[model samples]
Target: MSSRQGPVVHKFGGSVLADAAAFRRVSTIVHSEQQSGAFQHGALLVISACAGVTDRLLAIAQAAAAGKAEQAEQELQALEQQHLGLVTELGLDRGELQEYVRRLCAELAELCRGIAYLGELTLRTRDAVLGYGELLASAIVAELLRRELPVPVHLVDARRVLLTDYHFGNATPMIGESGYLLQKEGVTGALQRGEVVVTQGFIGATPSGIPTTLGRGGSDYSAAAFARALEARELQLWKDVPGICTADPRRFPEAQPVAEISYAELQELARFGSKVVHPHAISPAVSGEIPVRIRSVFAPQQPGTLVWHRRYDAPAQPLALAWRERCMAFRWYPKGNSPLAEMPEIVDTVRKVLELYVVAASQGSVLLVTGPSTGTLEELYGKVSFLPHQFVLACIVGNEPSRWTWEALELLRNSDAVSAVWTGVSPVALYVLLEESAAQSALAELHGWILHTHALQRLRL
Candidate 1:
C-alpha cells in the first residue's frame, strides 16, 4: 500500500531503533508500508541511537576528560561490543560491520587518550566526541533496513549537507544556505529514484568543514531541515509518547491526545518544556507551510497531532494543556515612587542570570517566571549581591486567561505568595503564579471558571 505520493521524511528517535529487537521492529514497519503501497514516494529515515547509548558515550567522554583513561577505555569497549553484538543479532554478516565497529572504537580510543593526556575535555572536544553515537546508529540501522527491505539505502554524512557556525557543543545551523545546497544538489532526484536516505541527527559541519554538534535534542531540528530540503509532503516524528497530550498523561491520567495544534501553540508548549517535540522542529514545517505530524512509535495506529500554519477549522477552544515544574518566580519591590523606573533593571538582571541556566522565561512587571530553581538563581547572581527591595516568588502558570485575570492578581495580592503587586507599571501581562502543591487545583479551578464565564466564547462574540 505504498502511496505514489513522492517522498516524505521520517525521523526515528534513538529509542525507536536502539537494539537488535528495535531494528527488527523498524524493518517490519518499513517493509509493511512498502508492501501496502503506503510509502509510494519512499522515505528518508533519520535514525538516532539504540536507547541508552548516548548517555554511556557521554560518560566515557567525561571520564576521559577527567583523566580516567582506564575507565574511559573500558566503557568505550563496552559500547563497541554492544553495537557489534546487535549487528550479529540482526543476522547480518558481522564481518563488514565488525570492521566498522573497529574503526569507530579506534577513533574513540585515540580521542580518549588525547583527552586523558590533556587532562581536560573542552566543550568543543566533548561535542566532537559525543557526535559519534548518532553516526554509528544511522549507519547500522540503514544497513539493517537495506538487508530486510527491497529499497536501496544511502547513509549520508549529515555534516556534508548541514552547515553550521563554529560554536562547538551547541552550534547554530546556516539553515537557509544549507537548504539551498540540498535542493540544488538533487536531494529530490535522489529520493525519486526510490532510495531510502539515512543520515545522523544532531551533528553538522561548520563552514570550514569541522564537525559540530547541534544543541540538545537537535536531532529533531535536523529531521525538520531534511524535510524542508526535499519539499516533503509530510514530516513524521516518532517518539515514545502516544502524541501530544492535554497534559503529561502519567501525571493527569485523564489527559487526552490533541488531534491538532497550530505551530504557534506547539512552540509555546515546547518552550515551556512540554517534552512532546523539540520546539525548533515546528519552525521548518511552519515556515515551509508543510504539515508536521507527531505520532507515537508505540501506538502508530493512533492519529496523533497535526501541526499546521493557521488555526484548525474547528472551533475547539484549546486542544491541550501543559504544566511545567520547578518553575521559579522572582518578585521585586522598588523603594517608594522609584519602583516603576527600577522595574527595567530588575527585568534586565533576571534575564542576565537566566542566560546561564539555559531556561526559558516569561516576565511581568514585578515577577519573572522561569523553570530554574531558586538556589540556582541565587548562585548565578551571588556576585551582584543585589538584594531585592522586597519580594517573594513561588511558581505561577495557567492556561489561556479566564475572566479572572484581574481576579487572579487580586488573589495573589491578598494572599501570601508574594508582597503587594507593583501598581506603577502597566499590567500588560496577566501571567499567574502558584505553588507546586496547588498548581493542579489552581488550573482545574481556572478551567472551571472559564467554562462558567464562557470567557473565550464571550471574547469572540
Candidate 2:
C-alpha cells in the first residue's frame, strides 16, 4: 500500500513464549514499550503457538486420521490441560477465559472425530487442525496483556484480515485484498484509538473462509505481511537468541552477533539455512522499505541486528555462515547428442516443488542439492537421470560476497574439507558442498578465517 504511518509491529515466536513466566515477560516488554511512547499510532503483536504445541497438534491429527480416536482425544485433553494450566499459572480469571479455551478444545475434538470417521487427513483438514495452536496462543496472550496493561487491548482473529490463496498447507497472502480487509475490519480504527491489537500468526483464511497456514516457521512471514499492510515503522522479531550471529551460536560458540545487516544479506543467510528468520519473510519488509529488528526477549536491553536497505559504518565482511546438513546431491550428465538446455527447466521444476539448491551447472552436466525433508525424489526418477550422494551445503553470506570468494575458496581448498565450491547462486552468498564427516571441521575453519580476515582488514584500514 502506502508508506509507514507510525505503529510498530512486534512478533514473538514459540521459543519466547515457552511458559507462563515467559508470557509475563512479554506483557512487561509491551507495557514498557508503551510507557516509553513506542506505540504512537499503536502497537500490533503477532504471536506464534507456544513451544511444541504445533507438533502436538500434528500428532493428534495423524492419530485421528489413522482412526485412533481415543488416543487423539487423550492427546487433545493433554493439550487443553496445558493451556488451561497456563491460565491457572497466570492467575487469570478462570471465568470466561477458561471457558473460551474449553470451547476451542471442544471444536478441535469435533475435528478429530471427523478425521477418525473419514480415516483421512487431507491437507486442508490438517491446516485447519494446525491453526488451533495459534488461535489458542493468541487468545491466552491477549488475555494476559489485557489484565497487565492499562490501555485497551483487543484480540483480533488474523483470519478475518489476512486473506490468502487456497494453498492449505502453505498459503500465500493476497496483500492488496488483505490490506483492504484489515483496515475495513477495524484494525486501523483500533490502532487509531491507541489500542494494542494482538493477532495469531502462521494462520489465515481463503476468500471462501477456509482456514490455511503459511507453512512451518511461517510466523515471521505473517508478521512481515502485517507490518507491510499496516506500513509499520519497524518490525521487531523477538527470539530466544541474543540476535543474528555470524553463525548459529549454539553450534559455533565463537560466533559473534552482527550489529547490522542488509536485507539482501539477511535474506541470503535465511535462504541458505539461517533459522533466525524465514526465507520468505524478507520480501514483504523489503517491498515496504521497513526496517526489521531481530531482538531477543531474554536480552531486551541489548540492541539486536537491524536489517534495512544498507548497513551504515559496517565493514563489507562475511556477515554469517549457514549450512544444511543431511543434504542429497544429484548430478546429471548429458547423453550423446543431447544438449543440456533442458537442465534449467528440470532445475526450475525441482526448485519449485522441492527444496532444490543448485550447487553447480555446466554445458556437460548439472549438479543440484536437496534437503532431507524433500521426499519427492521419485517424481524425477526417470525424467532426468541423477546419481545421488549425501553431502552438506554450507554458505558464506556477505554484502559483497564476490570480493571474498577467492579467499573463501582458497581456505576451503587448503583445508581439503570441502568436496566442491560454487558462487553466483546469489550475489550475497558463496556455497560449498562438503561431506558430512568434513562439514563441521570445514565450517569451523571457515568461520575462524572469516573473523581473522575481517580483523586484519580493519587493522589495515
Candidate 3:
C-alpha cells in the first residue's frame, strides 16, 4: 500500500526551463529542498514544454496542415538543433540524449506527415502532436536531474500514470481513477522508497493510451492533481517572477508583490484573469486544504507568495489590481425577451460552440470572454451575437474592494475611448470593457486613480 505521508509537488514553468543553464539552476534548487528536508514524504517534479517550444510545435502542425513542407522541415530542424544543443551544453553523451531526441523527432514527423496528407488539423491530432513537447522536455529534465542531483532520478511518463477521459486537447484527469493506477503502478511506492520522480505536466492518456493535453499552462494543474492523489504536504510552483504581484510588472510598472493570499482571492484573481497562476492550477490543493507557494526560480532565497485555505476578513482596501488583454465582449438576445433564469442555458450553448470562457455576465445578456478565439466561434456568435466589442479586463482584486468599483465604472462610462463598462458581476473586482484602440490610455487613467493616488493601500505581508 502507498504511504499516506505528505509529499512535495514542484511544478517548474517553461520560463524557468528555457535552457541547459535553467535546468542546472533547477537542479540546485531541488538539491537544496532535499537537503533541507522540505519533502517530508518525497518529491515529484512536473515540467512544462520549455520556453517557446509549444508555440513552435503548434506552428509545425499548422504548416503541415497548410502543406508547407519546406517551412515545416525548417522548423523541425531548428527544434532538433535546440534540443540537441541543450544535450551538448549539458555535456551528456550523444547516444544517451539521442535516444529521447530521435524518438520524439520521429513521432512529430509522422504526425506532421499525416496532417500534410490530410490537409487539415483535428483537435485529436493536434493534441497528439503537441503532446510530444512536454514528453521530450521531461526526458531532458530527467537526464539533467540524474547527472546533477544527488538522488535517484526516475522518469515516470505522465501519459502512463495520469488517466483522463477522451477530451483530447483540453482533457481533464480522472483523479480518483488515477489514484488506483498510482498505487498499483509503483508511482506512490517509488516515492515512499525515496526516489525523486520526474513527470511531464499537462499531458495525459486515455484508457486506450491516446495522448492528450490539459490545456496550456496546465503543468500547475498536473502538479496539483499529483499532489492530491498522494495527499501531499504542499504544492510549489517555480516561476520566473518573484511571486504573485498586485499587477503584471511588465504592464503596470508600480505593481507590488503579494506576500500571501487566501484561496478565495486567488481563485477570483485567476477567473477574472491573472496569469501569475492558472485558474485550475490549485484545485487539488484547495480541495485538500494544502498550502501552496509561488516562488522564484531565479531568486530561490525569496519566500514569495503563499496561498492557504484559511479565511481572511476583507481588509478595507483592495488586495491588488489585475488586467487581462484581448478580451472579447458579446451581447445576445433570445428568440423572446428572456429572464435572468435563462443564464445557465445560454452559458451551456455558448460553451458548446466556443473555447472562450465567460468572465463577466450580467442580466443573461452580455458576456466578457477571454480565451483562444477563432473563426469558428465568430461564425457561431454571428447568429445573435452583436456589437461583439473587444476590450481589456481590468479589476481591483481585494478583500474589501474600494468604492472605486462604482467610481471607476462611472469614470470609464464617461471616457470617450471606453465604448462600454461592466460592473456587479464580482463584488471584489470591477470589470471594464474598453475599446481596443483606447485600452492603454484607459488603463493608465484608472491605474493612476486607484493605485498611484493611494486610494487603495498596497496589499502585502
Which model scores highest in lDDT? 2
lDDT of 1: 0.66
lDDT of 3 by residue, 1-461 (tens): 11335678889989898888898898889988888877557788999988999999999999999999789988988898888888888887555777679778987888899899999999889988887778888888888778776768788889888898898788888888787888887879878866788998988889899988888777888888888887787788999988887766788888767776777678777765677886477787778777788999888988888887754654544566666677665666545565456666666666666545444545545554654455466544554464546666666665555555666666566676665555456655565666667788887777666564343344353
- Backbone clash numbers for all candidates listed: 18, 0, 1
Better of 1 and 2 by TM-score: 2
List the pairs of residues colliding in candidate 2.
Answer: none
Q: In angstroms, give how far residue 440 of model 2 lies from its true place.
A: 4.4
For each candidate in turn, give its C-alpha RMSD to the true structure in angstroms: 6.1, 4.3, 5.9
RMSD of 2: 4.3
Model 1 residue 322 CA deviation in Å: 1.9
Compared with the true structure, model 1 gives a TM-score of 0.77
Off by more than 4 A, model 1: 1-6, 36-38, 180-186, 312-316, 325-342, 352-373, 376-432, 435-438, 444-461
**lDDT value, residue 35 of candidate 2:** 87
Which residue runs does candidate 3 get wrong by more than 4 Å? 1-5, 117-120, 271-273, 313-316, 323-394, 402-424, 430-461
Candidate 1 on 49-167: residue-level lDDT in tens?
66787788789988987878889999998888888888788776555776886797799789888988998888878877878888788878878777877767777788888888999
**1-461, model 2: which lDDT tens digit per residue?**
11467688899999888899999999888988888877878899999999999999999999999988889999999999999999999987565899999999999999989999999999999999999999999999999888887789989999899999998899988888888998999998888777899999999999999999999878988898898888788889999887888888888888877777787777777767787876476568767788888898888887788887766566656878888888877776756565456666677766765687665775576777877644556666765655445678888888677777888877777665577787787877788888887678898988898778667766988
